[model samples]
Target: MPFTDHERAYLDAQHIGRLATTGPRGPQTRPVGFKLNTDGTVDIGGIRLSSTRKYRNIRERPDTEVSFIVDDLEPDGPGAIAPGWGRGVEIRGRAETLTDTDPPLAPGAFSREVIRIHPRRIISWNLDPAAPELRGRTA
Candidate 1:
């Protein structure tokens, strides 16, 4: 299922996301900061010019997957709550590198190109174990 407007907004509110790709060495995972657009596309930055492997892989194979956790889950501390409640979203999409102009990055940052993701499918789940009523809601 695809994400709804509300679910898309929830995903956009998140600051960090995980990107998964297949390289010559096999599965690769990296943390990234992303911007979600209203048109169901995602902009990902923080790639270095020298990071050719990831870019090459994505170029050769546009199919890719991304995941983001939307809930605020801080590990429980001595006085913190034991179980945290939140939701997570996963998207499968075709990735393409945007080359019209240099991506907006901080000065001296590694990545200058933005990878645009066009989502094909989206799945979401609430991580709270006690919240069975909220299960299986597609966003």
Candidate 2:
């Protein structure tokens, strides 16, 4: 699997993530909504997805690499401070623009077009309570 059980669980629980991609101008990063596919790939979709720069970046250069991350601060104690513990998963991979796929990733909120990321590397931190450090490896 591209992700460990803990990493998968963390990703599955999160709704928002950030995607970074390079375009003619430069690199661009934006907040996005994603879904975890059964094959362990990530499917990013949004309103007017195909017209977005991120989607155009992939469509322009099919091999364009992308980075995606999902993270949050979790309370460390019953009354933890405002800044809590940090945990997240980062995925780096090549992305492709998929248009008119079967059932849309998110029906009402997103379009049928989506950016699918095939992970080549994965980095995770604090997902496993037993190990609270950054861990990375090629997928």
Tell me, by TM-score, which candidate is best.
2
Write the residue-wise lDDT of candidate 2 on 7-69 in tens digits. 888888889999999999999999998988889989998898988998999899887789999
What is the per-residue lDDT of model 1 for residues 13-131, given as tens digits with 9 covering 90 to 100?
A: 67778777777788776776777776767777775732556566687666554433344553555533334644566776677876543553453564667777777666655433343
How well does each candidate superpose onto the true structure, as a TM-score? 0.67, 0.90
Q: Model 2, which residues run further than 4 Å from truth?
A: 77-83, 102-105
Q: How far is candidate 2 from the true structure (C-alpha RMSD, Å)?
A: 2.6
| Candidate number achieving the greatest lDDT relative to the actual structure | 2
Misplaced by over 4 Å in model 1 are 47-52, 63-83, 102-111, 127-139
